[model samples]
Target: MVPVDTLHDITARTFASDNYAGVHPEVLAALAAANGGHQRAYGADVYTARLQEVLQGHFGPTAVGYPVFNGTGANVLALQTMLPRWGAVICADTAHINTDENAAPERVGGIKLLTVPTADGKLTPELIDRQAHGFGDQHRAQPGVVSITQSTEVGTLYTPAEIAAITAHAHGLGLRVHVDGSRLANAAAALDLPMRAFTTDVGVDVISLGGTKNGALFGEIVVVLDPGATPGIEFQRKVDMQLASKMRFVSAQLLALFEGDLWLRSAQHANAMAARLSTGVAAIPGVRITQPTQANGVFAALPLGVADRLREQAAFFYDWNRATGEVRWMCAFDTTEQDVDEFIAAVARAI
Candidate 1:
């Protein structure tokens, strides 16, 4: 193993993504608290048990939490549970699973993803119907699941009513609904709604409930909302290789996140910072805010060469659309007002 002293500096931070931020202090403390215990491995520990209770408190009494290592694994495993050998999922083209997962759903899970182009990374019933009609056709992969992202990739949100409408439509078409809730907390904070409002109560069959994006060091949970709709997820999780052997650490971190609204507090702070960043950047003459600043991300299209000049100053971010010069700036749990101010100033200077 590499020497710890040779690692990247712990003090370094960035706005490239929330994944760049370090662990939340409270989540770290919980990990330390769960470090030295002889607990059963693989989801049988006290912490994992308590996490179920905590998750149920948010998702409903029947909600079940299955902790996985990262968002990709959670999405893959959860989607697998909702499909069969010949099943396909309908999702927005901009979905993380479609754009980011590198085809793991098809490669690893043998599941096909039927994608639709969405304006703001959200899929409506009209969009769902575009791909939902090929059932019982042996030549075509059956559409069995509809997966949606909350607080979407373009930093837009799905109001609870919007999600409810999609879920209702999906079920009517014999499709079970899955939420790739990698940023569910931000959507909840933005809408000021309980998690269940857009999830269980809205007929979401399963959710890849995220933690790493919000504040945990690294973990996401597959919340089984309607167990009847999802069969054999326990086995699917193992087959996907997402089962954490030392699960208490993962469970403890999530438990701490939900202990007293720490999830909401962290998400709200990040969202606030993004709103501030968007407001400041919009004032710059050459920078155009591309999408609404709905959560903790800002999508902007800058004048040609402006993004490269900004990168020279070590302001980290990525180009969302290379052809259009659109960039994505993300905020994290620890992002501060000062950070936003400095970034806005840097953008002004670069432009």
Candidate 2:
């Protein structure tokens, strides 16, 4: 046997995306614990079963979770199962499905996205009405589902009442509701509410529950709050190539996040770091906070040449909008106060 050697800097950090952060130690421990045992394949194992019990405790007994490999797969599978061949989804133009997924929902899932431009990366009932029409028009793709992202792409949040309003309006228009809850934990932490408070209790039909961003090595779940709203998901998961052959490991990671307070604790810390970063940077000359810091991401508009200079210092982040010189900085569960402070200093130097 050969020993593995480290290939990268162990202390390197980035605000590019939470996905860049390493796995939570607790999730790694869960993986180690689930390793030695042989379990049934393709979601028929004890760990998979236990995951359901745990999710039910959080989301209620009517909820059922199907584990998948990533957020894109979970989103595609959830939407694909909720709609028909000609069915389209209404979402904000800045949605991950519309922008970040590289058209996986369109190319892979064969679903059309009816996107509306939003100033704050959120959708209102009036905004939904923009695409909610044309139901019986033969030339148009039928609008069957409305998908909203929680702790949205620009780091904005949808309150419980806001979500409830969208759900009610969508249902009245015969459209099912889907929440792309990849940052759901951050929302829960910021709102000081449980998972179901803004979801199941508010009439959300389905959710794409995130794991990798919060603390897991890799995984997400397609949680059905209203089983009748999404049909054929069990079969569609495999059809979309999201079914993991060694399902217990995936289930174990999800359980590690949801089984206790790990999810909340990690999210709260990340959100706090983002708030700290937002507050620190807002005071700097020529830096403008562009959006509300309601989650684990901070969006700001930087002066020309500032972002490039900051990246040169090994403090990496992404440009949210090149036209506006806006950049996005994401804080992960592992991001420490020192990391935030050092990055703040770097930004000051760059400016």
How much does each candidate deviate from the true structure in C-alpha RMSD?
1.7, 1.7
The sequence of per-residue lDDT tens digits that candidate 1 reaches over residues 144-236 is 999999889998999888989999999999999999999999999988889899898888999998899888988899999887867898988
TM-score of 1: 0.97
Model 2 per-residue lDDT at 110: 92
lDDT tens digits, residues 1-351, model 2? 333455455548899999999999999999999999588999999999999999999889999999999999999999999999999999999999999999999999899999999999999999999999988998999999999999899999999999999999999999999999999999999999998999999999999999999999999999999989778888988888999999999999999999989999999999999999999999999999999999999999999889999999857889998888899999999999999999999999989
lDDT of 1 at 14: 70
Q: How close is candidate 2 to the true structure, as a TM-score?
A: 0.98
lDDT of each: 0.91, 0.94
Model 2, position 18, has a per-residue lDDT of: 95
Residue 218, candidate 1: alpha-carbon lDDT: 87
